[model samples]
Target: MADRPTGDTSLPPRAAEFLELRPLLFAIAYRVLGRVTEAEDVVQDTWLHYQDVTERPRSPKAYLSTVVTRLSINVLSSARVRREEYIGEWFPEPLLEDPYQEPERAAELADSVSTAALVLMERLSPLERAAFVLREVFGFDYAAIADTLGRSQSACRQLVVRARRHMARGRARFAADRRAQQELAARFFAAIADGDVDQLRDLLAADVQLVTDTGGNAPAPPRPIVGVENTVRVLASVLPELGRVGLRLEPQPINGEPGALARDREGNLVQAITLETGEGRIRTIRSVSNPDKLTHLGPVADPWQLARDYRESRRRQR
Candidate 1:
């Protein structure tokens, strides 16, 4: 156990303890709930409850972890209902920033937070997901996990086993090298920008699938666009329009994986496009266009920038 910090004179001891455990608390909340804003809210609620504690526990970190876990479970339960009524195939809000504190465990951290892992977790029961994250991702002992989840140690272990079995099928099956993945993503968008359908097909698997969430504000296939040929055709079909509107794709990391951030000519962000590759080819491409979800991404691209740039380019062409 790490040493608890001495609180500021103006602050309560419990408040100071929360600040010390905040990073881990937020990590637990975010991974459990899969929403940044919601996770922050959960942490805030935990602080409110902790500050009012008349009796401080012997282990502040453990106490705080328990509080966050319970709150997150409650949040996830209600959120599942709302997700069922969401406008389209919902995707977890992209975690543009990596928030893991342990540099030595960065790779492990990245694996846990990858879009695929987060998506697969949706299939898990709230208790199952909480058990896996606390034990597998955060290295909590089975006893600690049991205490946090209010389950028996044996039950906590069973939950983790069950969650792993459910997630094992979708775990990364391709190269784990980030550099290689980044190069592949760069080539993918380059091919898209050049309208090279053959190149796109070569980079995709036979069953390649694309899922886009525009939240009904922009045009997107209502259902997942699947299959190599069909996916290529749909993507290629958009190139002419993209060129006409001066929309360009730049390789950027999204949710810790190599991806493309679409921007207009003026460099405002339009979309966050992430790729999940396996067996040496692209398997899933996720493009999130929900404006409400992109607030943390900074400087949204003007919707009309494409047309404005097209007009300017045409003017110069003359």
Candidate 2:
């Protein structure tokens, strides 16, 4: 991931323009590509390429969005192949913080970068995803989206329509009450800490789904766990193990929704979880412990090693 610039207030006029739009550029790239590192790479590439344009554009935002969108589409093209060969269900890397949080369109922006929404986006063609993100997420009109994708305005509209249709097929009707989500999450975390199966079961919908992506050998099933009973069993089983392993989970906003982050005793991030709630119940739980995904948050402990340590601790107790 490109390191965000620090301690540099003395940028050239053009560079300053790029810096001002960096957040939007990164947001566009991330929402399209669904990967922080690749999005950051696109942002850096946009900056480098933008520096070479001697004549300033009439509109910097449009130009920057166009460049970053194209670069992200290119990255997503190659990324598709690896995703097909991935061992388990591939999830977009968890995003802890959104760089492009637009207050006026806050809910739309939040839902667009959401884990569930991003997962559905993976099914879309790169252009379709880009078009949808530009139009739906960022409020870009067809003309602007057309410029970004190098297509006619009508064609851009078509892409958005198709992408929206594809996404709607799998989209859940999530409750939009932020405060309700927070309150539920607080209770759910309390249940997890206590390993209270009944409360956990109560908080989850009857058909709640838990999808975990470790991306390697950690403590997660390769297949998804579905239903309240099955989810409760898995969650209850793992909750105690976390204590044994000296890992702690804290409720945090992840991807603009109520979620949790796990850390080891030494404060190294180990896992991230995003909760999707609806009708006052947790419907989907996304757990991503992938080391490659967690590195951006900071020092990522080796989950594989953590497993070994847990086993050793078990042996010592015996």
Supply the global lDDT for candidate 1: 0.82
Off by over 4 Å in 2: 1-7, 313-318
- Assess the local accuracy of residue 97 in candidate 2 as a C-alpha lDDT between 0 and 100: 85
lDDT of 1 by residue, 195-214 (tens): 88888999998989999887
Task: Score candidate 1 by TM-score against the native.
Answer: 0.85
Query: Which candidate number would show the highest lDDT if scored against the true structure?
Result: 2
What would the per-residue lDDT of candidate 2 be over residues 160-272, giving only the tens digit for each residue?
Answer: 99999999999986658988988989999999999898999899998899998876646778689999999999888767876888889988999888999999999998889
**lDDT measured at residue 236 in model 1 versus the true structure, 0 to 100:** 84
Q: Candidate 1, clashing residue pairs?
A: none
CA lDDT, every model vs. true structure: 0.82, 0.87
Full-model lDDT, candidate 2: 0.87
Give the Å shift of residue 113 in candidate 2.
0.7
Q: Number of the top candidate by TM-score?
A: 2
Error of 1 at 243 (Å): 3.7
